[model samples]
Target: MKEKQVLIVGLGLIGASLALAIKKEHPNTRIIGLDVQKESEAFALKRGMIDEIAESLDLAAPEADVILLCSPVEAVKKQLQIISRIPLKESVILSDAGSTKSEIVDLAETLGLENFIGGHPMAGSHKSGVTAGDERLFENAYYIFTPGKPKDQKRIKALQSLLAGTQAKFVVMSTEEHDKITGLLSHLPHVIAAGLVNQSKAFNKEHPGAGRLAAGGFRDITRIASSDPVMWTDILLSNKETLLGLLDNWRGEMDQVSEWIAAENREAIFQFFYEAKETRNQMPIHKEGVIPAFHDLFIDVPDVPGVIAEVTGIIGKANLSLINLKILETREDIFGILQLTFKRKEDLERAKECIEKETDYLWYEK
Candidate 1:
């Protein structure tokens, strides 16, 4: 095949990263990026994330072999409508990196864009924008495709080939399946995380010390609450029906737990927790899925100067890389807790061994 021209709209994190990954693997292929944010376009071009910056969809749509809509769900819907009116090439494969699929797929079908295929790359970070784009963001992640028609296998394969540079595991399913699964796994979690955060805020108003007492576990569980609210608001609204169903089921589960507690059934509560632990423990830890997992190690250290540097120095000397690190709590006289995050379990273990061998600090993994 001749060199492919890929046009990515919305040069945000996913769009810019896709451009970089494609360029890294297929240098001959041309990537054209377009975004409403002029700085994002300039940044992607200056960093060589894209070969060309499109002035408008009208001028770029015709030349693209593939067009990827990588904006927020609502923005993507508007782009699809605009692209529907644009005169695209006959062989152009249209797709998106949106979280939800059903609504987008329905819109495409309604617009008579038979070549449109729905895509959702199950990978992301808490960060946003072109600056945060990383070529390796989709590495080992699940890239799902939800094609609306049965006769689009050839187009699907071509689109897959175009995205092969991501090194993501590809899975195929229907739009319904994609929405329902993601609603339960991704959307519902965000709702619950935000709910928990709001609940904690209300509780903190009544008891000021409650917020300070929120430790590692609470922070970890509610981390998604820190995501871009506008983007998540669009996502939750787009998948409203699926989320409503999931929320109903979630409420029933909560009610059952409440009933168990009210009855003072010790065995029931014990079994509930035991079953939950077993199910959670059985989940795959190494694989990158819809939800990202953090491998964290907590260390107790004195609140003295160079104490943070000392622990990091030990890990660095062992050549172990940390994804992130922070001091969860520190006081003038009390020993502070330092949290170090690793990308893999092996690295976490190696860092722990290195720290123990070099220092007298007490450490535990979460």
Candidate 2:
């Protein structure tokens, strides 16, 4: 097969990452990047992310077999406008990493770009810019494809083929479906997190020591509040209608909680929490939808010295590498649960065997 030329519009985290991933998997594939920031082009070039930096869209779009727009939601619209006016080859397949898909897909349709396939790789870090780009950023992540038309499968497949190096699981859905679900799953969460942080800030102003008391749960839930403010602001506004509906639903739920608290309905409150916990527990921790399933082992270990080291040593001797290790639970004079995360299921199975054979440790798959 002839090597496909991929043109990336923005050289930020996602764009630079796609470049590196493609370079790693398909070295012969030519990557052309275009960004407003000269430093980003230099950084990606220095890192061998792109074969060449297109000085302009005129230079890039015409030659590209695949065009990936990885800019902010608003900027994506502008880039689309620019690309629409450009005389490009009909074979060029355009995809985007925008958070909201409805507008982008509609814009592509309006621009008569039949080959444009809207995509969002559902993975990223709070960190931004080309410097934070990693080849494995999209590994085991969901790559959503919201095509402008149902029959644009060929173009979608070609775009996916170009992004094969990212190792993301492809999910096909309509643009409206993508927007509504993402509005709830992603955009609304950011809004809620920011609201919670603001509420905490206000409380801390009235009670100076309140800020110092935020630990574990508060910190975990609000971690996304530290995300790029400008980017999030654009996202929040872009998905305003769907987010507004979510806000109303959230308000209704909060009102129910308030009513329960006022009435002192202990059983009702307990039931509410019970149902929520049950539903949350049912959510898939390990990827099951095309993305590679995670191999995690949760072990209950005694809160004593040498026990963790002993377990780790046993696994180490078996030549199984742990991707992540976390003490899930710990308390005074109590057995703690340790969670071990691995990249491959075979490693997890090996670790399980080693644990059962070498020690009497109680463990279960996560």
Candidate 3:
């Protein structure tokens, strides 16, 4: 039997990642990439991610056993056009990495792809482009699939087989459920982040020193707002029904907060915070769980120039491996917290001890 062929369309982070992942997990599959950017195609080839790179989908589509559509949420229409135009000899599994599922799933249904599933991996960084691609990005992330039809189960399994190496948890949900749940947990938060950044900027414009006071808390909360604006706008609009409903609920909650503050009800304010904190404490979330590493060192340092460089220098001198570091503040008044993850737990401990000896920063191992 001939080896299976997987065609990946688009060569951005997600597409490049899918190509690398599928090639790694299912080495038997012949991976081929179709990218609009010829330079990206050449890069993918040089990286050995794909067996070959096609200049167009017209040349690659018909030969693929599976088509991984990795276009942005806003480009679902163009993806549908490409899928619809493909002339596969056999029924090929068509799947995507689009964030909002309802619209894309509906479009896929209309386009007549036999085995269409809309997938959204709850994994990403505040970065884009081919260079940001990592095969392990989906590890431990929730990969949701919205099946086009009941008969697409086999195709779903096939996709799962290819991703088995990533160790992601597979979740099957209806398009509506996927949109509503993701909008509440994922989409709504991004909107709030953007709103917060805007509010902070406006405040800084009026009160000149206000921006200087915002420390780690502000940057941590507003980080998601730095993501691709066009992509987020497309997602928010695409899932308007779910997002608007969430926004309405959030508005009511905000009103309650405002009302309590206006009344000068300290007890009510405390109660609101206590209850919210208790709720958050129950969630299966950790500081390093989503964005940070599982085994990491966290430090609280007084916000000062050259403090980060000094700490990193200490750790580097110790020869400890650093996986990634997040600097939570860029201001001078307030102290900053440094969250560092290491490749090994031993390195984490070594880095922690080394950094602790250098600065007045208190350290905690998380």
lDDT comparing candidate 2 with the true structure: 0.84
Per-residue lDDT, model 3, residue 77, is 65
Query: Which tens-of-lDDT digit does each residue in 136-192 have in candidate 2?
Result: 878878999998765587887877777789898989999888888888877888888
Q: Highest TM-score: give the candidate number.
A: 1
Against the reference, the lDDT scores of all candidates come to 0.89, 0.84, 0.78
Model 2 segments beyond 4 Å from truth? Answer: 1-3, 288-366
- In order of lDDT, best first, we have 1, 2, 3
- TM-scores of all predicted structures: 0.91, 0.81, 0.85
Each candidate: RMSD? 2.5, 4.2, 3.9
Candidate 1 lDDT over 255-283, as tens digits, reads 99999999998999999999999999998
Candidate whose lDDT is highest: 1
* Window of ten residues with lowest summed lDDT in model 3: 285-294
In model 1, which regions exceed 4 Å deviation?
300-304, 314-323, 328-336, 343-364
